[model samples]
Target: MNRTDDISNLFSRFGASADSYLEFGSQFDYKEKPLALVPATPAPEPVVDIAKPVIKHCDTPLAEAATDRVPASSPVHASQSTAPLRHLLAEVARARQAEAQARNEEALRQALPHGRPAKTRAHVIALISAKGGVGKSTLASALATALRLEGGQTLAIDLDPQNALQHHLGAEPDVAGMGNASLNGENWKPLLLAGSAGSLLLPYGAMSEDERRTLERYLDNDRYWLAGQLANMGLGENDVVILDTPPGRTAYLDQALMVADQVLVVATADAACFVTLDQTERLLSERVAMGQAPLCSYVINQFDSARQFCRDMHEVFKRRLGSSLIGVVALDHAIGEALAYGQNPLLEAMSSPACQDMLLLSDTLKTQLKSMDVAESYAS
Candidate 1:
């Protein structure tokens, strides 16, 4: 049994297309056969016989004889005997048929309508870091909630293996890891995170060797199709899709970075985080030009200004990152408190300082997403 067999069984069992198809490969059972194939014998090749060309002279008279002929009374035989004119007529007919087909296809496409995709409001935003535990996931999840609350459908993808985002979002991840679920199967769907607003979430589960290879292709474009496969589910209804990536540089990270509507580089206010920022800058440069990233925001987590060292570090970063610095998050215990309870800070305690900062950050992010909608319209 192989992929084709499974496809046939699926088509036989249910007419609907499989909920998801692998961009790489599939599996199937061959026990059931829709029809038997009949083998045929190969045909023999044909041989051509040699022939000599027969050149014939026009039956019209010599030049001296027809030299005085009048236009209206010209002999019909001369006109009928013109082989070159007949060949020209065949060429004209072919060109007309080709032109007609092209016109019909264009008209047919124009007649077709496009629906708002389920993932329409879902935009893919990737948060990158140079190393582990830099608070990238925390910022990514926070931004997602902000965007959704601002009135856009959203899906926050946690592509990291630890699933650290679970702690921040306050829910046990639906996916325990690849060991618990196998995406090589159609039943394997991304775990959706529930929220009060316009967003929904799909958590990244662990992958087996084969599952990882299969999923790798979709990490970019046509090679891997999670984006398209999910889009096919009508998930595009939301305007933006958001993604949170694992630490350091990898092809998969690059893939997400390539498709991201925006990329937020997270770092602490320390010199080490600065090194990571430099590397991140280079990575982004290869994928997006200055200001072309749509929205490039820098978020320094656990920021504190009371401490002389921390305040000095903030000043240093402000000068370095400049306009790229979207906002700074103060070190607040309320964020951790909200996470322990599984609620967005916005919903947990609106009066908290962290929540206040988040509110402002959300407003700025909402504005960016709105502008994106307008930009998409103009591009179309």
Candidate 2:
């Protein structure tokens, strides 16, 4: 029996009609049915034509030809291009304005007079250090040399008992300095030694323990003793007197502060230096509060930027000092070499990095003096 005859027999046995199965199978046409359902692929996106037409020069009216060739969107494109040009023009205008401001500032600086008034006394600078062996004397000498080189009469007074400042100024090691003059009741002006490049040097001179004690007593007895002596020297308004004080707290430091118009504290970029500076600041705060202390700033000498520890300390100092940290002298062998040879580093190594730092310091001092003069003039 075939499968169709068996299906018809099964349907007859079940009491269902065979015509119903035939009708269900006939609903779907087998030959005409789709083999598989396939979706149509989407059409490709249309490309935008950004290429602009190039217009050539014509003998006829160019405006008429440009209107014909230009597209409707060209106006928007032109506006977009003009935005960058407008920004460039604005930048150029700002640059020109900045240049004009700078020129005006320079002109004002030039118009200001140089040096203090004749009625005003000489500007006094005191160089102090918290610790010994920090190159304070060398800096004092260099600064005086720099000022003298700028055509200002500069006098360097070595208050340190070591009398080592003269050595840096190319003076004889055994020469008697101001300390000797004070002991013998001789005028200090006669003891003033002419230094290299028209600078003046007054050494501390060799002193015995008793003589040193006597000088300290004199400074203690009179607060303005040093100031009086300086005045007797008859310094001109354009003259600058630099006092190199001994390291740490001393009567000499007090005398220097008594006569100084400005104080420059010298320190190195080290933990010990910072600790000493903290102590010094405490000592100075009382004087500053009383208005007895001179205007003070800091100088970081022998600064080595390559050392990470030094750089960290420098940042700390910057935070502590802010604008009062006025100068930094990079560590350079040239400075040591010049000192060893008993030569002024500012002149001996004029092209060295250390010399450049000295020049910057000198310039800062000059500007400060000028500002003070201007302020005084206004006050008067």
- Using lDDT, give the best candidate's number: 2
Top TM-score model: 2
Task: Show pairs that collide, candidate 2.
Answer: none
Cα deviation in Å at residue 354, candidate 1?
Answer: 1.8
* Segments in model 1 whose C-alpha atoms lie over 4 Å from true places: 1-121, 149-151, 174-182, 185-191, 195-199, 206-226, 289-294, 341-343
Q: Which ten residues in a row have the lowest lDDT in candidate 2?
A: 111-120
Alpha-carbon deviation at 368 in model 2, angstroms: 0.7
Find the 10 residues in a row with the least total lDDT in model 1. Answer: 217-226
The lDDT for every candidate, in the order shown, is: 0.64, 0.80
Displacement of the residue 375 alpha carbon in candidate 1, Å? 3.0
Candidate 2 TM-score versus the reference? 0.66
lDDT of 1: 0.64
Q: Where is model 2 more than 4 Å wrong at Cα?
A: 1-120, 148-152
Tell me the lDDT of model 2 at 225.
61
